[model samples]
Target: MVFSSESFLFLFLPVFMAVYYATPQRWRSYPILLGSYVFYAWWRIDFLGLLVLTTLFAYLMGQRVAAHRGSRQGRIYLTIGIGGCLLVLGVFKYLNFFVDSFAALWGTDAAGLGVHWRLILPIGISFYVFQAMSYLIDVHRGDARANARLIDFAAFIALFPQLIAGPILRYKDLEHQFEHRRHSAELFCDGMARFLVGLAKKVILADAIAPLVDLTFGASDPGFVVAWVGALAYMLQLYFDFSGYSDMAIGLGKMMGFRFGENFRFPYVSRSITEFWRRWHISLSSWLRDYLYVSLGGNRKGAARTYVNLLIVMLLGGLWHGANWTFVIWGLWHGGLLALERVTGWHQRAASYWLALPLTLMLVLLGWVMFRAEAVSDSLAIYAGMLGLNGFINDPLLFGAMSRESIALAGLAALVAAAEPKLWLIFSNAENKGPSGAVVSTRFPAASAPRAHASAALAHQNDGWTVTLATLVLGAYAVFRLTEQSFSPFLYFQF
Candidate 1:
């Protein structure tokens, strides 16, 4: 169930929290594991077995790899573990894509080739499989120790907060937390406040503009204005939607005393494609950098090999998202841009911030067309309209489809997305000011007291009662919206 759903917010979360806190410290992992499995099974019971078996396989292989460290056998075990995880992901996620492509090329039906049977992709298979592989690899590389405790390992893999959509926690980062965690009222309150902010982002912002996106994208021949409007809407929708999920996931982890790393920064404000990748989906980008790019020799291999490595990493990274040609093209598009930037030194060159910001955003917006489209052809069609190759006339139906609320909310979403960091700084600075226009100080010496005090006060205000009250109000509004609106699945869940 989604975090913004009524059942999740009102029923599952309360009950889960109650049971979780009631369980003793020694056996706390049991409830988390059980609750996680229940959460996954809520989507599809049959796939729950797949998740368990995969977890067991990874856990067992991790032990074997750890036992054989520094020998040929260790490398062999590592290869096998990695292969097994990829095989599972391949069969479930990419099998159909490969089969369909082969059939089309051969001018024959997939059934005739005995590959017509479709597999149901388990939700979060991409995320979990990657996690499992990283765990096995880290163990083999002697970067982390394999957990002998099956329950704790399983709990780490199936942690419901991040199981479905993730900030993609590394095993080393969370291994200790799984074994030992502390809980307190302050921590729990902070998590609740963060969760509420995420809920509002989804229910109030993303969902509000979704109908306009659906209407425009679903149109058979939306013209220039309609296509561009829809593209921008989808762009905003995606950020709030996926980032909202990440926020909820991180917030939930915090409540349970696990600190998942940040997944997003202000990516929209990036001045270059290089900077954008650094800010966006930070976990996945770092994963590709370390596991894929570094493994292929990284930038150590001179400029030519480095560009090829970047291309390969991004191509495979895109494929990891889904088994679609559109995703492949999307990856290639970014890879090409990144390569060009590296070769031309555009990334390092000084440019006007105003010029760079819009240029980067336009490029990103164009790329999103590929990411969001159902097929490569549809994406091209959208691009054509965006470039005004199609008529510039506005579609009346598309114009009428967007309600005033949708338009206002879309504008607000854009503003928030663009200025959120600055706004937060402003609020933080305001909150840090003391009575009588003086700055409060506790830790700093008299000379540097004001600056240090501002920093300390910002942190204090973040966790204070003001945040709690704001969370309550936003959470109540989200709940009301959940009851009134139709079910809106998270965009990243399909991946």
Candidate 2:
């Protein structure tokens, strides 16, 4: 079930929270594990078994790897663990693509070979499998200890909040939290506030802009202006949609006394693709850097290998999203840009954002078209249209499909995305003094102790109330809008 859906928001969450909080501290993982299973099963009961088997297999292999650390056995177990997870991922996620591509090259298709069966990819398989593999690798590397408790480990893998589309969690980061956690009214309240804001982001912003995007991308021949508009709207739609999920997941984790890291950090404001990776889908980037790139020799072997490593990491990273050739090109686009930046020293160079921002955003936007496209030809069409090859702006079908509310909301989405960092900073740190979050900035001059302190305290109080009231209103509106709107699945779910 989607976190924003009525059943999830009004039914599952309330009941889950009630049961979870009622459970004792010592056996908290039981409820979390059970609740998580129920959540996954809600999608498909059969797939739930796949999740369970993967979790248990990883747990068992992790123990062996940990036990044999620094030995050939440890390395073998690690390889086995990773290989097993990848085998599942490959078969489920990419086997179709590979089969079709090979068949086409061989002047035939799967049907000709009597291979009519197509593997069904379990939802969130990529995320959980990656989580499981990371756990085994960490155990072997001594970065984290393998949890002896099967329930705790299982819960970590199946944690509902991020189980689907994730700010992918690592055992090393959450191992201690699984064992020991603090629960309080304050933390829970903060979680609710955070969750509400994320709900607004997804329901109000992303969903609002989706129609325009659908029109543009789905059109037979959306012209230059329409294509740009669609591209820009989609850029906003994807960020709010995926990042909204991350925010809600993290907030849900907070409610359960788990701390999930922030995934997006104003990636649009990034000066380079290098900086963009550092900010966007940060968890995955770090995972690729540490596990894949480093494992592939990183920058250690030589300059050429370093570039190759970057390209390979991004190539696989792209494939991790989907089995589409568009994704392959999307990955190569970023990977090639990364390699180029490294060679040109552009990533390391200091430049004004005015100079850097547009260049980075244009490249990112173009790559995003590839990421969003159904096929290479579709992407080329969008690119051609973007260049005015389809004639600038005049697309009657696109115009007819647009709505006023959606247009207004798209504008608002742009504004919010642009100001996202500041908005997060303000509410998230409301109690802090001044707009800049300083105790003695322009609003509170260093002066007589009592007067200054009292004024600052009053200001902080106002900010706190404002944040609460604003979030409540936004949350309520988002909820209302959600009830009125049709089912809109998150874009990242396909991954």
lDDT for each of the candidates? 0.85, 0.88
Candidate 1, residue 223: CA error in Å? 1.0
TM-score of 1: 0.93
lDDT of 2 by residue, 1-495 (tens): 999899999899999999998898889999999999999899899999889889888988898898889999889988898899988899899999998898889899999767898988889988999899888878887898885588888889999999999989998888789889999887788788878888999999999999989888887677987889889989999999999998899889979998888788889888899999998999899999998999899999999999999999999999999999999999999999999999999998835547898899899999999999898888888888899889986677677678988889999988987888788778767634332224533355567598778987787788889998999999999999999999998888899
Off by over 4 Å in 2: 431-447
Tell me the RMSD of model 1 versus the true structure.
4.0
- Which digits, one per residue and each the tens of the lDDT, describe model 1 over residues 1-495? 878887888788999999999998878899999999988998899999989999999999999999999999989999999999999999999989999899989998789788757988899998999999999989988888885589988998999999998878788888888778878886676577668778888999999989878876776667888788889999999999998898899779868877778788778989999999988999899999988899999999999998999899999989989999999988998999999899988888725556888999999999998998898888888888788877785577667877989989999999999887875444333334221224544355567677787987676666555645666898898889889999999999998
Q: Could you tell me the lDDT of residue 102 within candidate 2? A: 86
- What would you estimate as the lDDT of candidate 2? 0.88
